[model samples]
Target: MSKIKTKFTERIGIDMPILGFSHSTDVTAALTKAGGMGVYGIAHDPPDKVQARIDAVRGQIGSRPFGIDIMMPKGMPESETLESVQAKLPQANLEFVEGIAKKYKVPEATTKTFYNTVLRSPSYFEGQLQVLLSSDVDLVAFGVGLTPDAVGRLKAVGKIVGALIGSPHHFDAYRDIGLDFIVAQGSEAGAHTGTIGTMVLVPEIVQMAGDLPVLAAGGIGHGSQIAAALAMGAQGVWLGTSWLATSEHAQGDHAIGDRLRGKLFAAGSGDTRITRGSSGKPQRQIRSAWTEEWASPDAPEPLKMPYQHALVGDLMTAIEEHEVDPLLHSPAGQGVTWSLELRSVAQVFQALSDQTIAGLDLVNSISKSP
Candidate 1:
């Protein structure tokens, strides 16, 4: 066998240690074809859609290894069926949302779409996990917190279980559960993120996880950042914002990518806020009118998980669709500007490897000179 590259490359059966984060199968397939791991996000897509996406990636990459990321929080909506959960939703939940919507002045349309997603099972996490297991996925990464029991089940199947964690506490929990890996996400990341910034969180998790491979996440966009993550003891880097600007991203809007690429630093600073008003739980998204409203001193406190997401999920959709006022758009990390141009996923992967290798050499040269 050829010599293994990074610690992550050896473990994931890839030539490069980069893991592309995107919901697009095209991106996943391209990354895998380029000799890196592609982690497709199937959190919101329905099972059929997920299956098709998986099939597409499989066709493009053949048996090349890839992974899937699912959003399954421990103890979220316990009903066996999505219909059951939707029907059984407490009126108090709706009332609670109405109160918050009024308090935050959230547009009526945005509230509807946000609620629909949380209540309906577009892709029930458990059901989709079953589908993923049926396929030839190299690993499974949970996009949210999970219980020890869930981790045990995943491990029993001889699959890697990667938990997305934001703090040292989360790192400790995943480590205790013997998770295969942990994505150490800092606040500078897009979409869902924790209060801890990447610079601080990456090292903390590397130290806390001990031997478990830590995949530095969040604001990692360029080779320098990836090198920094490796120097800090991360085995690899998990990327999203960088992928969003790629030609394969399916975001279908050059302007959106342009806006993201242009405002990378401006968008990633302390200006980012943690709010459950978006998808429940504390996710670091761009500060928007919606987040500002909920955070205002006079505004009412947001409800708990699922409830808050249920209430506002629909509204978010409406905002995206232009039916309601734009509140906030999903984004993460300070490394977005590095993704200024729309390159192929394969090109991006190659760039990361080249840059990381160059960075490592620089580090070694400096050490020798001293």
Candidate 2:
């Protein structure tokens, strides 16, 4: 198939207009091989291992222009230790976590779980940033906190930098920063997201972006959704949730157990809920006993960021370690409905590309009608 030419694709030098972001390097590499731009989300990696991880992913995607995604929030703790965050845990929170653990019989994690590996502090973020600045990454798209200084640093290193924005108000800052691109992620997106729907958010950001390229995200898992984004004036589409269902993800480094994957495979659009339970942020993820417990009246008021993650980190790690199917869940968008059943990266990419072309043809036919 011929390349899908868009302003963003042309500028970024990719054959496809789709930009795939995932926490798994396997999915990242596979997306690149499948023709889209793959952006590896390394927020979970230990700071010291960032470079090695980048190298591994680069090795797989050989010579392809891939990117990395990180959460760079402003005003985070400069140097907080895990013990310090643990010390702040209230007795009530501890008891609540214990109760859940007891109910599920989750065992103590034998090895270091990803929860303990994540240190939401400035030092960790900076460590990763420094490594990326000198790595082979082609683009940097950051979410969560707004960091203006990092933009200059990334550009200084000759890397294309972009930010994921949920609102139109965020456009000016990126435009002023001369960001290479902007991704307007809507509320329907999995994980941390804003309240605006993609339909409204994409056009607003596109209008604000003007000549700057815009990639529409959130609740976008199919070719028609990509087509819709293009129609909204976006130059391309940025996808995160779609990659979660790919076969590469299931077999990746941090892949979930068969039970959890089964849950995701069978999930419907209504199976997701937005809650601050997992990360102290409003994250839209698949509904599970964990999320349901948080929604219950017995649940305590969730803590803020960093603290919230610290509070539940152990239990989340335990749930995954034990394969507690009832409690296990992952961040996913409403678009998960369309991506039901695991497919290979190549197959998913081809389907989306074909659908996008067909959708464009349909739109063109309708426009020329009497």
Which number leads on lDDT? 2
- What stretches of model 2 exceed 4 Å from their correct place? 367-370
TM-scores for the candidates: 0.81, 0.96
Top of the candidates by TM-score: 2
**Residue-level lDDT tens digits of model 1 in 91-201:** 655665566556556555633322464443323666776787677777888887565766687777777778888888776566677778888888888787777878899
| Root-mean-square deviation of candidate 1 | 4.5
The parts of candidate 1 lying over 4 Å away from their true place are: 1-4, 79-123, 251-271, 323-328, 367-370
Tell me model 2's lDDT, rounded to 2 decimals: 0.85
Whole-model Cα lDDT of every candidate shown, in order: 0.69, 0.85
Report how far residue 104 has shifted in candidate 2, in Å: 2.1
Q: Please report how far candidate 1 places residue 113 from its true position, in Å.
A: 6.8
Let me know the TM-score candidate 2 reaches against the reference structure. Answer: 0.96
Q: How far out, in Å, is residue 153 in model 1?
A: 3.1
